[model samples]
Target: MGSAVLVLAIGVWLVQDGVRTELPPRPSSAQSFPAAAAPADDGRQRATKPSIPGMGASPPIRIRIRAILVDAPVIPLTLDAEGHLEPPPPDDNNLVGWYEGGVAPGQNGTAVMAGHVDNKRGLSVFYGLGSLRPGAEVEIERKDRTTAVFSIDAVEEYPKDRYPSDKVYGETSRPELRLITCGGRFSKETGYQSNVVAYAHLTRAKSA
Candidate 1:
């Protein structure tokens, strides 16, 4: 197989949250959001405002995991024609993308975040994702400046052919997060053979 086929296969392998499909074209400029603005002095930024999932749904702006020393911005991603959730732009190795159609990080369902393990150059945003263990904390900063704290439940890997999509993207009683990246042996013909998933649930929410 050619390099393009390898890259595309790896991209699809990294995303198992939505309907399986091929990768989409590069997102248009309109898909990108502006830089988050600083909070005003009046303390308005301290408020936790809810959006779509009603009570506590705010779009995540950044993600932090102190144990792994990961501090990365979050981008919203949409599915392509075949319903596959797009990965973060390959050129920006430090960013992660959240599946916009799914439950937000602070809402009452699983919120999926996917990132590349590495590109042709080197390590990517989620290169350390699988190293995270149970009890470690994953903090997601929302546009409202409130941080939704999640406690890692487990780190699991599954073969690409047997991906547990229903469990990974299934409904939950409380807010939860799933961090996904490529793992296992890599082959020029088939890409990574497994996916590394980090499972966590909300433990607390506070003003940033």
Candidate 2:
């Protein structure tokens, strides 16, 4: 998808459909990159073990993040007729949307996943995404009966208009993951003012 289309789709689909009385936790400044600094590549080389090889294409079936107690099924997300990527069904708070058009979770490229921060009933799947810290593990179970393990590198919140599409969706020589959700200020008119994105890189993979 075009970067412009992705920006619009994420801004629109990630927001809560109805007013939520309580907002999800926002990523603190300590978790974000310094204003003048760009996202670093050091994390990918920080692994102590020998680098693990990326796997072939295999759709993700589930995602588990022990740090925040996230254990949700992942559904393939496709673009609508209007060419906007679709979000997961609003009624299913535990479901996550995996951009099927992008690289799979275990593949040697950036894989994008998004979840709702909140819904009308209450906090949803990614409500605590901003709380994740470096070194936390995110495990994605794939259709091939393998689990791809990723380590958190950073969590940052950006205004919708200023989101760095290139950093989040850019290609990578190694497997990487991005978990996103609506965050920052909210309004009945605009939904949300910003988005919380968690950056991670694959560390290991194992058979399920």
Candidate 3:
């Protein structure tokens, strides 16, 4: 996904009572947001191991982030008629949505995934997303019976109005993954004040 074609509009679901007991953590002060002109070093040590080669396109079936105890099913998400990306059904709080229009996870491009931070009931699938730190692992299981393992590089939150679409949705030479959800402040009228994004690149790939 490129900046021009990126049309995601996430974190719109309202939480119960218009408030949440716990908000996801922000990126450590040492990390810096990627630059719009070019990707910047997030101040984290790059993995010593070389990145795995990209794979053929396959729909992701599941996503796991052991550091945050996330293990959820992955569903395909599409752009609505209005060009905005549609979120997963609110009825299933544990589900994650993948942008089907983009390259699938493990492919030679940035893959995007999203989930609700919380629903009317409470915390949802990506409630702990912002808490993840550099070096953490994110595993995506694909229909082809393989798992793409990624290592986190940075996590940051941006106000909705100022979202860096080019940085977050930019094309990449190697396989990369992005996980997103609502973050920052909340209110009855505005839902979430910002969106949290975790950037990572494929470190390993294995058979199921």
- Top candidate (lDDT): 2
Worst 10 residues of 3 by lDDT: 37-46
Q: Quote model 1's TM-score.
A: 0.75
Provide the clashing-pair count of each candidate structure: 0, 0, 0
Q: Higher lDDT: candidate 2 or 3?
A: 2
Say which prediction, candidate 1 or candidate 3, comes out ahead on TM-score.
Answer: 3
State in Å the error of residue 153, model 1.
0.3
Ranking by lDDT: 2, 3, 1
Q: Rate the local accuracy (lDDT) of all candidates.
A: 0.66, 0.84, 0.77
Error of 1 at 136 (Å): 0.5
Q: Which runs in model 1 stand beyond 4 Å of their true positions?
A: 1-55
Q: Between prediction 1 and prediction 2, which has the larger TM-score?
A: 2
- lDDT by residue (92-113, candidate 1, tens digit) is 7688888777778888877888
TM-scores for the candidates: 0.75, 0.91, 0.87
Report the C-alpha lDDT of model 2 over 1-208, residue by residue, as the tens digit.
3657777898998866644777778888888755654442445343332235678999999999998999999999998999999989887779999999888998987888999988766778998998998779999999999999998877999999899898777766778889999998888888989989998878899896
